[model samples]
Target: MTTTATDLRAQAERHLRALVGRDDATLYDDQWAAIAALVEDKRRALVVQRTGWGKSAVYFVATALLREQGAGPTVILSPLLALMRNQIEAAERAGIHAVTINSTNSEQWAEVHAHIRAGEVDVLLVSPERLNNPGFRDEVLPRLTESAGLLVIDEAHCISDWGHDFRPDYRRIRQMLAELPGGIPVLATTATANARVTGDVAEQLAVHGGEGGSEARKLAPQPTVARPAPQPQEDVLVLRGPLDRESLSLAVLELSRPEERLAWLADHLGELAGSGIIYTLTVAASQDIAGYLRERGHEVAAYSGQTETTERLALEQDLLAGRLKALVATSALGMGFDATLGFVVNVGAPASPVAYYQQVGRAGRGLPDGARASVILLPAREDRDIWAYFASLAFPAEQHVRTALKVLSDSDRPMSTATLETYVDLSRNRLEMMLKVLDVDGAVRRVQGGWTATGQDWVYEQERYDRVAAARRDEQAAMLEYIATSECRMRFLREALDDPEAQDCGRCDNCGGFTVAASVSDAAVQRAGDRLTRPGVALAPRKLWPTALANLGLDLKGKIAGAEEGRVVARLTDLGLGQALRDLFRPGTPDQEVPVPLVQGVVAALADWRPRPDGLVAFESRTHPLLVDSLAHGLSRHLGVPVLGRVAIRDDSVAPGQGATNSAQRVAAVSRRAVLQTEPVAGRRILLVDDLVASGWSMTLAAHWLRAEGAEAVLPLALASET
Candidate 1:
């Protein structure tokens, strides 16, 4: 049975119908074009279509067709574990053998590898991060790249810095494509790239010969990887479809308060047609909202990056089977969960309109004609604060990056991130991001023990960084505009992405197609307010000092004993009273006496606190001495407890910010200065008071010293935590 190109295309169409479980299924012309380019012509292509446009079908069908031609396995660089899992399940319906190598399925890697080597795998999915792993990069990648039938980048926009959700790990893809042998089909796909990101990605694809020979735009500083000369730009076949999702009805609800928004969700979640997602800006909000909804009798659960991998799989299944009403989630649950979601509600606006479109695109994916899913936005005032917090963690200053590189180059051996933090002022997240960027740029490498310098020439590229920062600010402003605009919401989103065919969707609130009430019951608002305003969050005791501190010449290592459990009056991100605490502790704000309301709140918190304290002790703060002293004296006076002497610091000792950003360095810095002033009180119960707690190391070290002085218990009380 010799199959011609037309026969193969017809067979692929049949497979698509069988995969979707509808005999009447038909492939869109663009989908057919993309599949043929990959399987028949063996040319490179980029497919930019909206979500649920059968982008997966193009790849799955192409993989099957290519396999029939006796080609090697199809390699897919999927971004998230959830996306990989969904793709693998979808592949199964088409009777294709798909296996994944990821952090979650490490135990089965040997089996997967065996399957690949045995020609038993039709498709192999790996995270882009896997490309940098020493073992995989040196061993598995060479084999896969050399023999791969096709290379598919699921969310291709991540390869470009101009993309809203750019990742450094994706930069490795350019190098991977350059090394790939010619005559191999390559495909890149995304649903959320704007014109700028699209051009950036297209340039890279052209440079890699995905396009026959388009001039490659130098997007970033050149990497050290060896690259071939640019081919002709005619090689790339781009299939861009309309960005609008016709099955969605979009609207915006302006709620003045967090409590009121929560009340509205609790009241209207049941009214939404079918199961959907409720998106939040943070993990704390997701958990809080999920808990509140459950108490109000909605079958909901929280999903975030922090959720255990196994539990996340189960939660996704629950949502898919319609066993749960909604999964309150953060951006971690954003990409590629192929469920026929009926609605989506945003509790807070994302800083980028492109990001918002990608998230809300999850709804109505599988809806039939005449059926529409609801997409609503409930914008909050606190969103800007959250945005600022995240923006502050962006790329480090040039000096910090240089310092890290110099330290790594001079080190005799690999240095762990904790050890590296001892030399850099950047936080753990920022430092790690810098290192990854350097790793891709050929300035550093990650070995078995830790990170090491590669001694390659590096440039700061200030211009590129500035451009990215400016782009981010513009995106934030656009998000604000999206919330305020009286025009079509969907149209605003599409236009933000610079979609060429964008027009009035005629289905958004501003278009008068649908309306969602902004009202909440007074009783529900009162209850939600009570929940939000409720004070006191338990602070878990520090179990162990950070590992490898001894390696940095600090004696502090191993478990931190005698550090009693702690509590805070409230988190800085809490819904109720959070804004007041934020303003009170804001940077550059003058040191002042504790507010009366906070004093009263602390009094309320202590009433519920277990085991009344015998005495109150204060810690001297280099940052806010007056605040600490006032708070200690007020709590002592209100509780009728004795005032113990202060734990003073030596003038010669370093401040908290002067030391490493790691726990061990902070503890070492604090330990050199913290000294008890009063005589030891044997067998006494002590309450340690501080104005604010950032890392909790100082409090832990203080408790260690107090326990050494014969204190029975140490209870840490702070006004607020920077959660």
Candidate 2:
């Protein structure tokens, strides 16, 4: 039976009133109206909206209207089992007959299949992982195909390789549609998707638009009759920015010590009343921190990969019901989570800016006032250095795709952790992660023995993976560059992602001027003559050494002893005494100021040091300071003004006139002057700096920092090549 626009509208209103209330019918926005029109026309559609923008409501209303008018069963494919359960419960609450097929159903699968075929079930919800079930494909879907079926693929971005979360099973969706009796109309919806993913969905669905004329002409004639008109691409609607939540105050804290960080968290929990989530990187970290917080009299629950699905569901339910004050979780907590009353706190730097944004999005779901998001930086120098380094690296899409493919293909047979690592170059841990994604996407099948590539079309799937991987890599690289930039973090993010209304968030670390001052400078220096004798210390060893002496740099000496004859041990120890050896073997902390250990007569000898035939040199303590000062002056002149300052000074007594060519000079030249300050400017040009170009880590970090500091443009500059 054909339906008119007016008829569909009246029917939709009645359905909406039945499900929610007469008041809720008026809540349908203009976007929902547009979506309803598409459903009335019986056309496939893709709805792209931000999180909490009511995409689900629109679909729910559309499904109800279609069912009331005797439209065929509406099948919803979700990514998570929890999501499936939620949809079923919501449908049941609305008086709609809904049934779900998930991991828990063994005895009920046959009953559910029979019910769908007999048209007894109006709405069917299932996880994407279950689509490959032969029972559904061969028995139930065939009967449903006799009537026009409505298929809704929620979280549609999972189908795109470029999306943050990609699923291999998403690719199987097209095949599933083709196998059905009458081609079912599909509605693909997602919270995020750029141009590339949008195009991919259209191509996969074989949907044609204005330029392509009609979808029929674009497709080759097949034995099966086409069912309905393909949906046109809808324009992406971007909402206004600065989703400022008036009730919550966002802040960032830079803690000086680990213990202090815990204390700060405890104090904040004591002060804040609302529920909250603390996000950490690892499961162990989340558990450890949650335990500490609980010990401090704060009620807290931990959520990680190790948490059982049942337990996690219970904990989430408890949090939403206001039974739990706070929860500590890893990245897993954000997806499909709906808690309208709370804040999100990041324990350390997120792996990427996208991740940070998604986690923060958890708050302010439906509240009139927005929610708060905070990031806390720890005190350790190593933490700072590591974060800074991570901020610098570029994420190239092609490289990641190639790496993922190589890993996937290396395994002759689909194997899990232990066996897969022997064939793939990736670490066992990383391989397992990719496998999980593949398993979700239905690209691989899991059995008692191991995993197998169940995807029928390997070539096309591989190409899809490549394209999406490349896009992801490009996005990551661009994002990294944006963050390292010396501009307003908001401006860089907005410009890069094409978000027009981005303002100075005023909540970032740079915007808040939360950086602490360095405690020391010129911490330590090694002599130039000492470096020549200990060249091995300066270079990484080619062979592995015993773990005991690994950090002390003694293993290389042992290797040299093995290479030599009876005098090996004695000769190796003698090398340490040489001027070159002493210079290169010296190790010191990254602190700015290093105290020098005084030696009798060495200062006088170094004052008149000269070069020897072996490329060694000597210098006095006072002369060493004078030499460093002169070099700083020369650098200042070269750089136009006085950017250079005293970093370190080295003394040597092996030769009086060896000059700057010695090992000590080389080391000084290689060292970089770390930036002390960075401020965010609304519209200022900035230059990004990195220590080395390896993987462009330093460059990415510098650019991100620059953006955070409010620079308009950040040009990346690197000092050395990582390769």
What do the candidate models score in CA lDDT, each in turn? 0.84, 0.48
lDDT of 2 by residue, 471-590 (tens): 545665654554455555544444433344556656554565323222211111122122212221111111222222322222221221110000000011221222121232223422
CA RMSD of all predictions:
3.4, 18.4
By TM-score, the best candidate is: 1
Least accurate 10 contiguous residues by lDDT in model 1: 212-221
Where in model 1 is the C-alpha error above 4 Å?
1-5, 209-233, 652-656
Which portions of model 2 miss their true places by more than 4 Å? 1-7, 17-30, 104-108, 132-148, 177-183, 207-251, 256-258, 368-497, 500-723
Model 2's C-alpha root-mean-square deviation from the true structure amounts to: 18.4
- Per-residue lDDT value at 577 in model 2: 25
Tens-digit lDDT string for candidate 1 (1-723): 877868877988888986777788888999999998898888889889999888999999899888988999999999998898899999999888899998888899999999999999999999988876878887998899889999999899898887888888898777677657888899999999876676677667765534322222122335422122223246688888889999999999998998999999999999998899999998878988898899899999999999999999999999999999999999888888889899999999999999999999989987878899999999988899999988887778899999999999999999988888877766777788899888877788888788998787889878777777888899999999999999998889889887889899888999999889888999889988877777787877888877666656777667777557778888887766676788888888998898877777787788888648888778888788888989999888887888877778875557645554566667667767677775565688889888777788778888888888888898999999877
Question: What's the lDDT of the predicted structure labeled candidate 2?
Answer: 0.48
Residue-pair clash count for candidate 2:
72
